[model samples]
Target: MAIKPRSIFEEVSETQKPVAAPGGIDAKGRGARGAIRVWLMMLFALVVVMITVGGLTRLTDSGLSITEWAPLSGSVPPLNAAQWEAEFEAYKQIPEYTEQNAGMSMAEFKVIYWWEWGHRQLGRFIGLVWGLGFAYFLVRRQIPTGWTGRLVFIGALGGLQGAIGWWMVHSGLQEGMLDVASYRLATHLGLAFVILGFIAWYTFSLGRREADLMQARRAGDAGLVTLSGVLVGFALVQILLGALVAGIDAGRNFPNWPLMTTGTGASFFPPDPFSLTPIWRNFFEDAGLVQFVHRMSGYLLMAFAVFVWWRARRSPNTQTRFGFNAMLALMVVQMVIGILTVLYSAPVQIAIVHQLTAVVLWIAILRARFLARYPIAQSIRG
Candidate 1:
């Protein structure tokens, strides 16, 4: 006797019984996504902490502490009086200590020493977490083939960031400079943003896959994705300009927003007129111009975000509409934070928030982009 074919609903319900509930993803699948999402958020948070610690290290003039670059050995902090003295002696040989921190005792060295130590330790922890997490996913065969290559690429980028950090430090250790090269400072910050952007993109990708599997596509999807990508690009550029401003300590001079200095008119330009010559000098050495440019970039980014939101409102997709609105709100908050940071001369609390808000906005934009691209996929999964 031949068996009759089951109805589509009956077949689906049978499958659901084994792996997931009706209208829900499986427990294992949900758990995997949850773990990955948490790890990505943690990485983002760690970057913010690293940036804050770096700012403090700069403010305290502690970046050059423990001059030696013993990547393996330096992981262990000084444990005794003799070890502390040895570390202090290493620091004393650097120009920063001799020229700027001379006459400082071992006790004083300890203060700065700890800040640098904490920064390095955070870097190591990030490496370990990413490495172990990726291995776990790989062994379980849970990570999709499409994402495996990207994960490896990001892991390598993390390693490169470590090397770049030491390269930045090595500049100050060389003979002539009392502080790290401003250009190196800019590069270090630029790489941090790169890592951040990648993380935001990856997290958005995962979220998009889930959403696609849940919701069906509507209209204006392609335009929305394009707009999202544009917004993220603009935000990244603004972040780079902000790094330039920080590198030259530009915040110290232009404490006012909407104007370069406290004065009025064209005199507000850097005193030298052709002031920032050689192009390169303008980016790292010309404090006034750097800050001015950064302020202008912020305004540009805000305008772009608002425009994206306005266009998204016209789209038929509800999720895209919500994401665009989120992007718009974050943009406004970020602009306010940037102005406050400038007006406050980049105070530690405000400055760190400014940096963090940028990351948040990037993530929002990424979400919008992913939603737009995968609407159909989501509907099928649902």
Candidate 2:
């Protein structure tokens, strides 16, 4: 065989294709992004349902029905006749039972007791789902790099939320108290949204590969990001304010729109808006004042959302723009729902619907904010 002549220049001139450093965990199929995202979506749905159920429990004045924070044994509600009477007797000691529902029949007591029991049960279920999913991912060694901490953080928050739930319930159990303190209620609800927000942001991030996210982030709109962030803050504040309103049943007291009246005449503020002693209590306990603050905050939030949507119109990404559009549209719908809720005196059905809309709007705002922070890359034709 004749030996082929090799040019000395060939060795130096030819470029070597470097190995791509084994890609990343994603390329190795270790990220489990899709599986984790599905798990998060499940958590998201459950949390939404939890929020709605919690709202119903509050509205029905059933939150204090159980009068106990039994995380483990409480799961198995009153099973027999004696057990039912025992539970009812315990509830009868609370001011809510003694002062508000004093004449509650066993059947009537059962209804509220079920509401509270179911609410707590749902919380336990959520915690279970989170724990099982987290363990599965951890045991399988499939959690993405840096994500184990995030997942653990969520679990931690869930635990803290349970504690806060008990704290809120304990408030109403105290003497002379008819309902949970408004501030405590707001704190509990606020944490729920915070947990939801983290899940949502993680879910959005996991939908794409980390490399793609890094690349797309380079093209994200800074102005829109800032604006959307501000809008998110406003939306959350409005939501907390709404919680305060619900906490005190303020919406039912102020049925007049465009003006909060004592039902006989139009007035901008509630009657004796600051009648509560110590002055500060008015912000939380005074129906007229709390509802008024919620209303004004909604107006400001709506206006800011409109401004953000207008700013989003200038973004190059179609999906990002669409997200903001949905956000603004939902904000409008939520506002209208709020008005109707007040007009109808916060009836359980209408009030629950209003609360559900707030959830949707919240997710919408978060979706838009995510798009702003990590926009999808698009061709110039887009």
Candidate 3:
């Protein structure tokens, strides 16, 4: 038996191929990967809810009610009359209280107070959801390779957005300032959209296995990929402009749509667009100019969307074509909602609907872009 070992050398006539790298097999197609993605998708939905609530706070003029950022303790609202008075006293110090909402009763104060508190509460909940989910996956070693950094970056952005929320509120507390600065509000909203876009992108990327994604990458369409990027940039600019419109209450000012009007007659540009001090301030503070720019940008966005849809119609992949179709339909509906929002002077219910549609439309565009980058395979049959 011991002498039989010598036969090993005789059997080694053909050298053994090196063992394949460990775990080189496609484990990416496993269920754990999909589970992590589902967690992220849940976080995405929560953030959307947070945004909608924030919009309500602003619409109800409740953004300045909290007066402070208590990341931990502020979760609980006032429980007693004395505590309520303390909160009300802090509010009274702000110009929004002394000048705009002067002499408001306690009951009225409670209404706006609840709206803002709810908004902040939702933000905290979203952060908790993201942190817990990320931490769980990270501890379990369930996060996919190259995704740890992505998840951590999202948490960092969420933290920054919270700080920015306080910063925006602080602006409105300044002497004689009735609301947050338009630029600041735009920054806050822009970053939220950025976070949202990243989530949407990661969600889309995780929908397929690594092997499939790699294979799809080989057949990627560069033209559509480039156009989708352009579309995102184009849409972001329009979104910022819309933020400006919201900040300055410009929508209420231009109640008549398709054309802006003077107090006495009709005009293309807002009359006296340069009236604000320092001329440049007009862009940020001028309602007429901001509203006019927002309207014009909406028009341009619509035109570009039409072009993207036309190109998408030529895509050979059925799923890719459908993605583009959904995006185009949402864009068109968003345009109509934008017009209606202007015509009706941005009533709370209607404006909220417009905003919700905007979130959906944004997600749709992201889906189309994801498809463009890594198109889904399709059958040849009709």
Candidate 4:
């Protein structure tokens, strides 16, 4: 006798049934895991937005407006004219206002103050959202075993980011410097990226069990992983260089691309890297060399991205291929933007877009690495 074919619903039901795990998560657990992953992704996107807005604040030279850090009280902006004048008076005492923005009115102060205020407000919002979501997940017991610690660690890092922001600001306030220290800027941006990467990795780790199995099956590509890691490293270095360039206003000096000047430029290489004396100075000071290094780093990053794409094109997996192509496209666009920003003396709009693109490219490469490492399984139907 011939057996009847199973209905699609039956097939799906069988597939969806929880598989016994040797200390691994079950089907019900997987649903919760997916939810957590979504929450993390959303949080990560918020962080990216914060970074973009922070870039805008920096570009507009509005980062130092508030001139004070009152984590709780600062969340509420000025409510009346008296409050506004009080805040403006505080800003006026800063060397930035006395020496650079002398005679600036309260209304003008409000423009920059609002941008800085918005940035800080966003940070607080993110903190509240994360705290509430995490607490809810914890109380519900939906948070996976061994993951709570990591979650708390990330939360602490967020707190640290707040502290670091003040520390960076303090550098400028104490020395009467108009701009923040390059090293502190690097530290701040680096931490932001680290938090971003952690969230991305956490999200990827929460994929379904079937997806984990697929990843296990295709885990022999060591070279690809290494290459991807190197690309990520390259991108990060480029970010640091860009930060330094911004800190020193280096882009203002070099308005030509592919060459330093209109015709044959000054020597392609500085006679002595030590010309900037005190190794730290070369990294943060010496505007000409800093800009030159940033430009060269961009070229290096583009070349590396292109090479990665070329190799990925030969991979059997469609996801890896797509990732490689996306990285290539992003690199090219980023390079063009970098050149344009330099040529045009880092116009605010273009500079902000450039910073935003860096975040986007960072996320894209991260996602690509994740997919390559953890290929998802196709659902089986009877």
TM-score of each: 0.81, 0.94, 0.93, 0.86
lDDT of 4 at 264: 50
Instruction: Kindly indicate the candidate among 1 and 3 with the higher lDDT.
Output: 3
RMSD of 3: 3.6
How do the residues 130-151 of candidate 3 rate in per-residue lDDT, one tens digit apiece?
Answer: 9899888877888887788888
Q: lDDT score, residue 303, model 3?
A: 93
Write one digit per residue (lDDT tens) for candidate 1, span 1-382. Answer: 9999888777453343465466344333443665676777788778778877877777667888967677788899989999988888888888887888889987788898999999899888888888998999889877754567777887888899888888988998989788888778777877887887788767765654443444544433777778788877777777777777766567767777666654454344554424656776766677777777777778777877788788878866566677778878888888888888878888777877777777677777777776666643225333
Cα RMSDs, all models: 6.5, 3.5, 3.6, 8.1
Better of 2 and 4 by lDDT: 2
Clashing pairs in 1: 212-377, 212-378, 213-378, 213-381, 213-382, 214-378, 215-378, 215-379, 216-379
lDDT of 2 at 4: 92
Best by TM-score: 2
> What lDDT does the true structure give each of the candidates?
0.75, 0.89, 0.87, 0.80
Predicted structure 3: lDDT: 0.87
For lDDT, candidate 1 versus 2, the one ahead is: 2
The best candidate by lDDT is 2
Clash-forming residue pairs, model 3 = none
Clashes of 4: 0
**Candidate 4 lDDT, 221-335, residue by residue in tens:** 5677778888888888889888888887888875766666633555565334457667768868877788888877887788788787777776666666777778778878888
